[model samples]
Target: MERQVSNRYRLIEPLGEGGMGVVWRAYDELLDRTVAIKEVRYTGVGDDKRADLNRRTIREARAAGRLDHPSVIVIHDVVEEDGRPWIVMQLIRSRSLAEVIREHGPLPVAQAALIGGRVLDALRAAHATGVLHRDVKPENVLLADDGRVVLTDFGIASLEAEAGLTATGGLVGTPAYMPPERLNGEPARPESDLWSLGATLYAAVEGVPPFKRDSWAATVAAVLRDLPGQPVRAGVLGPVIMGLLQRDPAARMSADEAAHLLRAAASEPAPYGYAAPPAPPPGPAGSWSDMTGPGERGPAGTVSLRARRRGWFLGVPAAVLAVAALGTGGWYVVTTSQSATTPTPAPTSTSTPAPSRATASPTATPEASTTPTTPRLPAGWRRLANSAGQFSIGIPQGWQAKKSPTRDSITVTGPGTPGMLLVEWTVPDKPVADPARAWVELEKEIQAKGEFAGYERIGIRSTTYLGRPAADWEFTRQRGGTLIHVINRGFRTADGRHYALYWDTTDARWDQDRHYFDQFVKTFRPE
Candidate 1:
């Protein structure tokens, strides 16, 4: 007979056991779903102290329940039975980061950085709600099979609004990951949590904690008195890790700076001559393809536009010509005389003249000289400012600009040019989480529907631009019987605004004109 708790949760098996509790794989009869239940227990204490511990467990669990983030484990229910609290939580099918490192050795620097970023996101969310995760270590991080890096086990968390719960003289975190201030009997601050995060990222890439020692006492001493050895494998994450591990919390790196550096590290290109292992076959039990539903392969940091809106990027309609005739100073439009012959695609290589090459261009022209506020343009290049879109970019001499029909995007083209550059910013309701993954999903949808004629993919790579996560998608497709190469970069602003920069040229001129795309990206500035 299986043991039942609160007449709702049925214990299936013990998942793991630790000093404070035993986590069980339990079945929730009422919800008809699997859940994880942690049974809190106290030993070597008198009845009065045990009762106090029970109350603290319930309070902490309730405090943790207030947190809501994609990277945070959800707390479902907390109940007391037989003088102890049981915390019911979302059951994740995954292994802890500690287990992964132990079994597979150290992870790659980029992978470690990615995991660290997710954990930091969760920490920021919790901190915003006045909760501190007192125990943040490899054992508390869950790498879910569904490509989620989740922070779990908030059993020891503390609420800033509440008074201390721990007994008069007791520490409540793993020694190796604890900050120096915490060891010196100081209260845990947000920066203290950052220190632990740094230690966690170090262990993730080094296979050992920065302050690991032979015993608990030695580890505590090392954390409080000694400096950590430099991490050789940390790569771009080395400074971030060391900065967070500073003994003086006041001198540590700020969260914003850490986030920027982590994103940069996560987006670092693979080492030279390195090749990714082939993805496993789709039918495997734990394969990502098998876990996700059709067209839902996790956050790809990209959103799909409605089918009718697809033409905004591929073809310019008559409505755009009408917008040009209005002569609005903000509208980048081509002349009406050239509208008939111009294919006017949002931006790409086509036989027709580009919409931007008209004799009468918009008021926003290339910068004649540079100011401290304005980015300097290369020789023969000019800055084009779009007041309506609140963005500015550098374009080569003689390049013209045209506004899209929706007025949310702009296209620029040069005289007799076979290539065009487009800047778009029509973000949807939901923001993308992974830009590279979004491109992969988008590619599948387009290919399945045969949208692009003779389309072939080159690659979709993760990267960072403007200190934010971004991705670059490169491909080739047939346009008017001519092969054209295209690259589209998508990213979100710090304030959640999404943008994409697209450029295309005929295959014959791709090598010569590709530099324009790079220059455009380098000079783009969003107001």
Candidate 2:
């Protein structure tokens, strides 16, 4: 081991101790960042042991960073300091899903689904990137502050390591979360992960895994030969739980399919429990004490009946409670009439005035908001009268736009080397290239630009444009030799019509136009 290790990180207090490592709260000196540094001891063991440990540490770091999904914990860096290996991860101050369940028995079906969906999404990304998370237990899943599930701990995750890196014998995962295939020493696969996710969800909804026993061996036997108990019929997670627990991995649904179903279930009306923190208290128009206090007839902090009925945040059931208060922004805090277990104090005061408009008649849930039929320009994006819809934006005056013969839309370009803006329209029944294949093609385009340039491909996200089905894509590519990069956004409407836009410039120059990129995505309306 070397002295003091790297100058960048100052190791702080020990967070927790593990079988092979200890996690410390460390301050990153170089980046001025706070991160968790996990230190694994490398006693004067054989070279094989040291190599295996190093490989495990490096593999975990690579696997976690490879997944860009929000539901996966972010890995910052991995380093070997003074004869010991340490991996730094984002320091999240939230309870693990396992601890949360232990504190509050079983979670409601809706909450479980919300947490489950996010984990599955991360798994989808991991599998697509050729990593198998062999471990998917509750302890490894964190419940983020924003109410999202983040999967953690890939220390034993299988990856394409060199020949000397394999951990022989029982080097897999927790028995409860390990699928039968993995326990049998068979190769781990995506289906095995789905089985673990099912077990995690089962515990979330039923307060126990289908097979829990006093002895570890008994538990293993039960997992291999027995069926678990049924989850409470409190919500729509019933079928989903059963499907995930199927013994045959082939019978289990893929992570993507499971996520879609979970999202659909979360969208429906139900007796959902728990509260989402108020949307960052709209700039504090005034204090909760000043507005509605001790004894008020109409509940304070609630939205007007009209606004309540309008629904917000995935139609969160509490939105309809209607506790009216005065504020310029639309943030909600509970009144005395609401839950009695209020935790935090009311927000501060603000000067901005609330909008004065006739409340639109109550409509369907927010999720059912009208979809855009075609891309229409969003409010406030022009010198005057810009016709390209929200899905479109103005580029530097010299750039040009040309229609793609194969695609229904346009491809814009500028007077330069090999760079072009590609756009295409999609309609129902017409199949777009598979995402994996599209990524391959995009990789080719990226490699052609430069050897070390980086590119990010955001997933196909669903959004309503006006009142039709539409999806938006953002592709950011960096090129060599120039401090510039290219950004392209494409939209596909419900009817299968699609449009794509691109921008090419150095990063420093593009900073001036970065805000437009966000507004472009939000305001895109399909007419």
Candidate 3:
């Protein structure tokens, strides 16, 4: 049997539940659309207190409804039914940031920065409207399947224009993420929210809240007394995180300063082992190209062939390539003397490859061919199936394929050129919805971080590929004093699989070898 609220919204199922409310997946009978309804329940309260709580719930919902920001959740309606308030909101198909961290371990530094920036944007918007989100933690941040980083669950939000709603001596937010001032019985200020944002980002990159303790009282004590543990994986985000977690709200970083730093960190190329470039000189938004001067290189300030590969891998997810471990002579060696070989077993977490070389089959077996529905490969190209990565691609005759240690990607290299073709399929639980926008954001980070020496961009454009949404990113960069041309195509298939096909070659030979990219894409197949 279904439950109806105010004869308009029909409850479908419970999406989630908290101590005070249950959120439902509901359908609006009047609007003929799906929406989320949060049923707020009050227990163990007198009649007068219950009425006051109901009034506060409606006021908060109305205040949240007035907020207009892309990153803020949309509040649809507040309905009174069965002597309680049902707050309707936009139905978002996504997982919380906490769930993502739990499933994938800690996020990459750049990824954490990007998510933090979006969440902060929402907080700033709420602050502008005098709506203080009392709870800003990983559990309240949603990574939507449509590529939106949304801040939600403003149920306990405090409106500046209104009187205090919480009872005396009662803290309203999670202790681990609460600012010290808030724990000391201070009012909720904008800076307190910034402190919470810092803690959320800390958890995003380090996989745990900064002040987490065995019990609530201990967590509160830790927040008030102990300094947070140093973040090891925060990389460019370390300073920002530490700055926001300051005990004195007055001494903490301002929202504008934090925004600038987060933007810079989000654009950084690699999370570790490199100092991020200084924040670009203040300019119009989206003017990242003006940051670097001529001959000004990235953090390391030089671009070797191996460094270029390392930077590219770092830009993607779950990249575990140890480029520095592969010495120069070993990386470029053409294994022509080796005969036909069997597929090597996939490397485990503790596995270590020989320092000289990783094993790779010289040719594809019969089963590696594309399905009959797809185009056949050219005479000289062979479709190689990578069982570990669960994908097949066509490569030129002389090129050799090396699988990544994590078995999430395969890189094909040829005899003489420094160029290589990389295919990666390490999709996160939340795949990108808009590829073109993603590339634009990535380009900003790459340029701001100065990862590419002598970097020049052609363009990033959205297009349709193989009857699916796709984007093409083309650019040129200097590698070992030789100009290199590169184009990367990313798309999500109908069955929700994400893949990237990247090809790079010398500028002089780009036109000559460009057909190889077409052949590779034509014969590519995802298992």
lDDT of 1 by residue, 1-527 (tens): 99999999999888888898798888999988778899998888889888888888899899888886656788899999988899998876656788778866787775677678778877887888899997899988876533346788888888877747864467889999999998999988899899999999999989999999999999999998899999999888899999999999999988778877876675554331111111111121111111122332221100000111222211111011112222333322211100111111122111111222112222222122122343456776666555444556777667767665322467778876688887764312111334455566556556666767888777665554555545566777886678988777665444333467788889899878877787788778655
lDDT tens per residue, model 2, 1-527:
32233777787667766566777777887876667777777555788767776776676667666665545677777777666667778776545677667766786665576567667766776777777787899888875422334687766666644323454554557777778776776777789889999889888878777778988898888888888677765367777777877888888776656766675554333332222111111121111211211331221210000111121222122111111121332321110001111122221111111112221111112123532332333332221111222133333234444432212234444453344443332211112222222323334433554533454543323333333322332334444344444443332333222333333445565555444444444433333
Badly placed stretches (over 4 Å) of model 2 are 1-4, 42-47, 160-164, 272-527
Which prediction has more favorable TM-score, 2 or 3?
Answer: 3
Prediction-by-prediction clash tally: 7, 32, 1
**TM-score list, all predictions:** 0.56, 0.55, 0.56
Ranking 1 against 2 by lDDT, winner: 1
lDDT of each: 0.65, 0.50, 0.65
What TM-score number comes out for model 1? 0.56
> Over the full model, what C-alpha lDDT does candidate 1 score relative to the true structure?
0.65
In candidate 2 the C-alpha lDDT for residue 313 amounts to 26
- Residue 525 error for model 2, in Å? 6.4
